[model samples]
Target chain A: MRKFINEPSKVAQETLEGFLAIYGDQFAQVPGTLAVAKRVLDDKVAIVSGGGSGHEPVWLEYIGPGFADAVCQGDIFAAPAPQSIVRAAKAVERGRGILFVYGNYSGDRLNFDLAAEELQAEGHEVLTVRVADDVAAAPPDRANDRRGIAGGFFVSKIAGAASEAGLDLKSVQELATLAADRTRSMGVASAGGTIPGTDEPTFVLPDGKMEIGMGMHGEAGVRRADMATADETVDHMIRLIVGDRSLSPDEKACVLVNGLGATTRAELLIIARRTAWVLDQAGIRIHDLQVGDFATSQEMHGFSISVFGLTPELQKLYDAPGRTSFFSGANRH
Target chain B: MRKFINEPSKVAQETLEGFLAIYGDQFAQVPGTLAVAKRVLDDKVAIVSGGGSGHEPVWLEYIGPGFADAVCQGDIFAAPAPQSIVRAAKAVERGRGILFVYGNYSGDRLNFDLAAEELQAEGHEVLTVRVADDVAAAPPDRANDRRGIAGGFFVSKIAGAASEAGLDLKSVQELATLAADRTRSMGVASAGGTIPGTDEPTFVLPDGKMEIGMGMHGEAGVRRADMATADETVDHMIRLIVGDRSLSPDEKACVLVNGLGATTRAELLIIARRTAWVLDQAGIRIHDLQVGDFATSQEMHGFSISVFGLTPELQKLYDAPGRTSFFSGANRH
Candidate 1:
């Protein structure tokens, strides 16, 4: 297909250069590793996160003062290598500590853990928070076996904000843990996204049918039912999420309705509207709402809804001000 | 044909409802109007803008503390009515003045002007800035008639920062003017975007073909050409943009490679990466870079690149800090 570049291989590198020029002011990058806080070597309780490229404002935008100190970007959806993770840790090597946050995928876990070990040997503080919020990645009883989705946004935001606000390394880790404990997310897809320079999708969807519980990276969801309206879709998703979480009717919550690459803001807003209506009718007070393409799936035509159960302290931190490419007002009411 | 909504009609309203609960805390209903903004009107100058719903994070994410004080969301790719624009202005009116900034479309202009006239009758100081940054809307001979694309982000940010930093309504208007003058954007579309709930696209593109200079609303580009590699496409678009603006080899500037809608971040990043390589080879001293779906055209698989030549003052404002739903660290470098 017609595209915008001279060579496919050169695309990623050039884009990174432009990305640096654009967001470089926001993060400090070490050649092989991730980008850390510009002056943030001061406090150790660090939070590092990453993923493959192509999910803009995801791994990178989520990196900043209030969230991840650094984020390692791999080639499109490819896991970053061990050296990159080690470099991310080295950049944020404050005496306090460092926490690596990411999905529970085999590639990410192995590399991040290896980076941690390498850093520990070098006498740098290190930790890792594996995000497994995607219920579709595993069976109901095997929730921990699930993969990560947009829920990474909430987890990373809380963790980064805590770290930037001067929480000690362990304390920051605990903050992400606490936040992650209260967070859950799931998605539905109408189509799959193709990797750049490749014609095949990660998977496939049937014509006139939709896939619910699809992972951000093309993992199959729990069901493939007949499609429905925006309201009906929201109802289906909310029912599943509420049933899983058993949320109280009166609890205040932060809600996120994200576009999975190909969904439009208009479509997303419609979904969010229906979600709020369905949610408000259930008496759940939505204290915050974020609707956009936060964590995309290449060009998949789908969306995911994530909820962050909040405590007062976590809420305060969620509302704190910070800088990043994607969000600075995560959960700010 | 699988999609994610119940009815097409109720989409925008629902989306705004969900948005209001979270990122929209800065906004409130304008009493019988569909527009929204912050409470207590912090600054005297209120910047208002909005149009079709599909271009998320544009008009919506732009309305906040440091950006436009109010936004008027419209139907999918349709302009907000006079009623909505009126609502937007009323909500945005903070006393210093109110300014309306939208694209050069007839619908947006007519409605905004009508709202301004009506608001003026009710005794409010209002100003207007119409964006015509798309070089293809009209020939360079009649650039004023060109359409506005995703470049609205740069214009809005610069103008909003100016207004928030206490520029008079006229000064803020001028800031937007200057930025728009220096900005030129062109795009390439791989596939077409489908209207939600509709099985067909507003337009169509043959597979393996590309349309150069397509509008944000899926309007046919100036020409459909064979798809090329990222660098080739970049060269084509840049030649047009550079020719239109007549930038000198030594001229410095910022660049944006934006997805029309369904263009993957990985794809866009690759595009951005390659574009940077080309400019670097030409010895172009790029000042900044923005890559993503800044202004989208639903799920259309395409991208647009915008270059904004900066003056010192414009650069400073471009680098200033602001917090909002879609962006942060949207400040000067």
Candidate 2:
């Protein structure tokens, strides 16, 4: 493999070890576990999330004052074990309660759900919010079954802000779910990411072909067709997401254009530019905008576009001040 | 090329257009020029920097309240024209003088000097601080003749903090020079980055080979050898940089492991983990640490290591709070 790794099998643990060594001022590993949490815990509803490794700065980097309180980690691209989640949840809880948030995927659902049950059995009040916002994964009628992707970062931000604002556990959970409900995302993949410790990519695509609606782990996209221009790709993504949610001309949204690992910031901005133009053409207002590698699939060459339709409540939460190791924004609104 | 782009020639302008569209809240384009600046320029020494494109979030992302006041953008891997630099400096200048900061490159030196001459002729005081920290590019006796790469980021941060603290142009320039003097960096490349508008990579390394000390724009490295483990690569890089600087065991420094573009966080952390261990073994103290794609080459599969020795003055500037659109840090010290 052409990756800068020691042992492919130890990529996850070693990454966490190296991360803590450099940024230990901000975080600490849950004792004897592959989980990480903020160095200092606060007395509020604790927000926790986790999944497999490889998506750097996602679950781990979000742990800080206004974001996730703790994160469980698994092997590469695999969900954390339920016990790991239970330990992380237990470690970060204050008297307020514990709130669990994560992307909607089969492995994650099973593990986080099991951990929630375990936490409740241990006498801690726990709530769970699963983000299912990839519009291409399911129709509106089956939105709950859709897989979550980059848009979930905004949901986590909303949860962090609400929890930091001293909302009750139930209120925070409600806000997180609302944020996820208002969000929809779709992506196109120009190339696949390589699995660690191997000389192979997760999947292969013939040259000049783009996979529309690919998942974070190189799962099947909507279709394989000739590669399109950045504007054309954004056009298709916007069409699917807007149509799936039946968004109206009167609606306002916070738009995010996320790079899937290897996409340059220049390309993301191009896509974001097109997204704004297209959204304006459709009479949709952009409440806020962000473009970067908020979410990624290793070094996959692609981008995902997400829009979170903003109600006044969701808009306020979205605009609230927030900070993390990887992302931050002011409450300009 | 596999990159998501429209016309290759328009990549630079389109990227900037997209960036302004998304982040226009914090910055605006200088009219009729490929330059960007913070919407509000404070009455401090105006700091400006820019070079080629493709290195996302470099000169452009560093523009904000506590950072650079303006940046002149160039096309892909090319330096900005003198006219563009003059426009940016003139547009962002307050009553205070303007300071030019950028990597040490012949093209940039020629252009920025011309701009400085123009600014001086226009009755504006101008100072320049060119960073030359690439240890591999020159012997110790000729360190000033070496090229600058990722280490210049820390110098910019130091300059920004000093300028924000109300330092005059000469003082800010001195601190920037100090930062550049204390910093050293080197890199390794596993694969070459593809240039826009063509199917060709900037350079190619055969599959089982790795190049050590490659520059950001794919400049030739010190040597190419069989791929080694992450530990071994870090070992080689640390030996070269530490020995070249004649760093003593008693010196304390900030370490930065920067991704060229396509390297994953997992790999960066692994290298960082080893970097800390290796530095400790050499009895050098790590005062602060950062690992990310601070400077990149459009998704190239490589990383660079930069170390900045911390004097009492340098450490304070390093810990000073600064804010930019893409990065920020607290004054923990």
Candidate 3:
């Protein structure tokens, strides 16, 4: 695989090393651990999230003031070790409790759960919110089992804003869960990404074909079909996301067209245009729209559309400005 | 080539349409042209930068409150017509005059010249600064003839910040030219990008080889060599940029490692790490660091390193926060 890396075995450490080199002022490594915690500590509920290494600027870059407090990362496509999570949680805790937010996946969930227990054992209050927003992974009856994708951004934003607003731990947890529940997302992959040091792609699709519903880690998509126009693909994905969320005509929602990886901003903007048109035609009001590679799968050429139905309360939090290495918002200077 | 587009022919218009759909609140299209101008006008020298399409968020997304005043885009890899530039300038002019900043390419230079003439004929003041910072394209004696790569971002930033600081037209023009002269960049391309609607790539490289100094639009590079590790390639690139600029020890510079397209953020952060080390070893203080796909050749797998030697004055402007759709700085919010 053509990638810029020194050694495959050290991708995680090296990546973090690089991040720390430039953004050292904003993020610091949790002592002796593979976790990054924000430099500043405050008496507010701490929001921490992470999963793997390949998705740069996500879990780790998302840590700072007005964003997540800390992030625990694993090797490429692997969940963070539980110890890493515990260290990250402890590093950022200021007696305000901790909220662990992450995409819903078996490995991440299990490790984070163990880490939460570790925190609780230390007398630290901890809450977990698993974002299961990918509709293609499960039916509505099995929504909780669906894998999370880009919609986790919404969950993190709500949690961070609520905590920043001085909400108590329990209140922040409730808002995070509400935001997670109101979110839905679906993705289409035109190509799979190669794991570092591996020549083979995470998965493959036949030439001229695209897979809808592929997970961030290249999990099996719902189906494969001939590659269609961007508009058509977005139409299909948005239908799934909107139908699963089932909002009324006047309801407003935040729309995010996230590039998985390797997708051009030009193309994402096109997808964003189509998504807005489709939503407008459906009589749905758009609360806000963010179109970019908020989450990715290490240079995989694909994108996901995420919609978060917003209540007046959630909308306020969603609109709150955030300052992360990877994300900047409207209120940003 | 895998891409998300409707018709290849409509890629430019469609992409801009998409940008306007969500960011219309910030940018408004120049009537009858493929140009976008900031909606918020002020009694400051207007800074405008743009070129071909495909480079999402670059010359276009850079337009906002404290960034660029307007952007004019052409078809993929081609310069916008003079009429478009003229229209963009007219839309954003607020009596302080206009500053045109862009990469030093023949097509862009010619089109912008024509537009400047048009503006001058209309009794509007206009200044032009062509960024030619790619050290690999020419020797120091012919630096003015060298092609500009990602360093154009620095030129635009300095110009925009100067304009926002309420500098007079002539002073803003001088600062922009100074910023351009202080900048140096070099790029390596692993794979070429496909132009819209074309099955063939703009250029091709052997699977195990890379081209150093390759232009953003696939211009011939200095040499072809076997693929090297990220650190090795960056070492080669930084050496040229530093030597060409002849930076003294104890100097300060802003380091920017920009991905062309298809390069992972993981790789870029790693590159940023190495770049910082190299600069530190040279005893040069880094005033700021930015790493990402600031300017891209759509879906091209490559990256460029740009350094802008900063005087105390330039440092202040560099530190000044600017807000754009894709980039936000400390001054934001």
Candidate 4:
């Protein structure tokens, strides 16, 4: 493996240690648990999210003001245990209750739900909103069954904003659900990433071929097709996202062109350029555009496009200042 | 050849177009020139930095309030022409002259110096400070002959901050030069990236081997050795930087662990963890720590470490609010 890792089995723990060393002033690990919680707490609803480890800057780096209050990280491509989730919730619970926001995946749902039940038994109010935004993961009739992907970024941003706005648990939960429902994403993979400690990649594609809608962990995508140009790939992904969201002309939306690991910022911008043109052609006014690595799959080479159709309320929350190790939404002075 | 580019020849232009499309509200292209100027120019000495285009977000994304007032972009892996540099300087000049800060490359030095002459002839004061902070590129006696690597980020940042504080052109230039002198960096590459419009990789490494002190564009490094673990690599890099800068116990410094291209954030944080430990062992206090892609060679699988020993004034300026598309320094609310 060409990675700078020491031991494959300890990569996840070391990654978290490294994160804390750099950002410990703003975030800290919950004692005896693989849960990272914000160093400062507010007397409002708490927002928590997490899943696997390899996708750095996802749930971990997103834990800060106007983002998740805590994150429970699992091992590479695995879900955090229920105990860790409960520990994270307990660390941030401020008596306004706790709301769980995360990508829609079976392991994540099972663990978070179990954690919710435990928190409820302890007399703490708990709610959950699973982001189901990957259009190619399921048909329209079963949208809720779709895997979440990069659109979970939107879900977390809005949810964290609502919580920061001092909304009650139920209200924050509702807004988070709405954000998840309105968001859609699709991704194409040029190459799969290798899990640490393994010499082989998670998956492989023949030269000159690409996979559409690949999951963050290299799960099978909708199909494998011959490689296409950046514009062509973005057009296809945008079509799937727009159609799945039933977005119409004259609507407003926030767009996120996310680079899966190994993709350059230049390529993301190129993808963003094509994305804006397509949205403009459809008369969809882009209220905000964010292009970067919000979520990633190790060193996987590809990108994902996410669109969050916005109501005025959602737009306001989305525009609110957010500060995180990975995503920064501060306005220029 | 697994990239999302449309045409390799148009990659640079399209990348700029994509950047403008997303950031048009804050920046604009100088008409008929490959120069991007901040939309709102201040009355202070203008800060301009640019070079080749492949390093997305380097000089282009750095153009904004509290950063570069303008940036002149050249084609991939080439310096901007003298005319473009002059054009960019004119776009942001407010009778307070211009301060040009960028990496020390022969091509860049030639063009920027030529532009400085032209701008001077037009009755505009101009100053230049070439960043030469790569310790591995030269011996101590010939430090000024060293290549500028990721440490240019610190130079632009301090220069931009100095200018934003309403310092005079010469004062800003002095502070920028001071920043350049105090900064040190070293990089290692496991694999090289392919340039746009080309099917061949820029350089190649045999399996399980890595190159130390590699240049941004895959220029030959100091040596090739068997790949080492993250901690060992970071130790060697930190030693070279500390020795070159003569960093001492109790000295405060800012750290930047920059990913070249394809390295994952997890790996970066892992590197950061070791970086902090090593510095701490030497009794060097970390004033600020930033781990991300400040400067990158497109899709190159490696990273660099930059340490900026901070003076009190420099530390204060570095902490001042600065926001760009890629960086944010607003205090958390």
Q: Which is the leading candidate under lDDT? A: 4
Candidate 4: where is the Cα deviation over 4 Å? A248-250, A330-333, B330-333
Single out the weakest 10-residue window by summed lDDT for candidate 2 chain A. A324-333
User: Per-prediction DockQ scores?
Assistant: 0.54, 0.66, 0.59, 0.61
Give Cα-based local distance difference scores for all models.
0.76, 0.86, 0.86, 0.88
**Candidate 2: misplaced stretches above 4 Å?**
A248-250, A330-333, B248-250, B330-333
Query: For residues A1-333, what per-residue lDDT tens digits would candidate 1 score against the true structure?
Result: 434444555544555555665555555567755443454355547677887766665676676667677777776677878888787766766677788898777888877888888899988878777888776677668877878888888888788788778878788888888878788888998888877677888788778788988777787778898877777888988888876786675567888888887887767877887777887888887777877778887778889999878888988888887656666464553
lDDT of 4 by residue, B1-333 (tens): 688889888888889889888888778898877789987877899999999888877767887667899999899989999999999899999999999998888999999999999999989999999998888787889876788889898888899999999999999999989899889999999989889767687899998999999898898888998999999999999988898777766568889999999999999989999999999988898888888898899989899999999888888788887777867772222
Ranking by DockQ: 2, 4, 3, 1
How well does candidate 3 score on lDDT at residue B167? 98
Per-residue lDDT of model 2, residues B113-219, tens digit only: 99999999999999999999898787788877888888988898899999999999999999999999889999999998888777787779998899988888888
For residues A9-102, write the lDDT of model 3, one tens digit per residue. 8878878988888778777888776789888777899999999878877777778667799999988888999999998888889998999999
Candidate 1: residue B324 lDDT (0-100): 62
TM-score of chain B, candidates 1 onward in order: 0.94, 0.97, 0.97, 0.97
Model 4 TM-score (2 dp): 0.98
- Superior candidate under DockQ, 1 versus 4: 4
- Looking at the true structure's interface, with contacts defined as alpha carbon pairs within 8 Å between chains A and B, what fraction does model 4 recover? 0.67
- Output candidate 4 Cα RMSD: 1.6
- Higher-lDDT candidate of 3 and 4: 4
Best by DockQ: 2
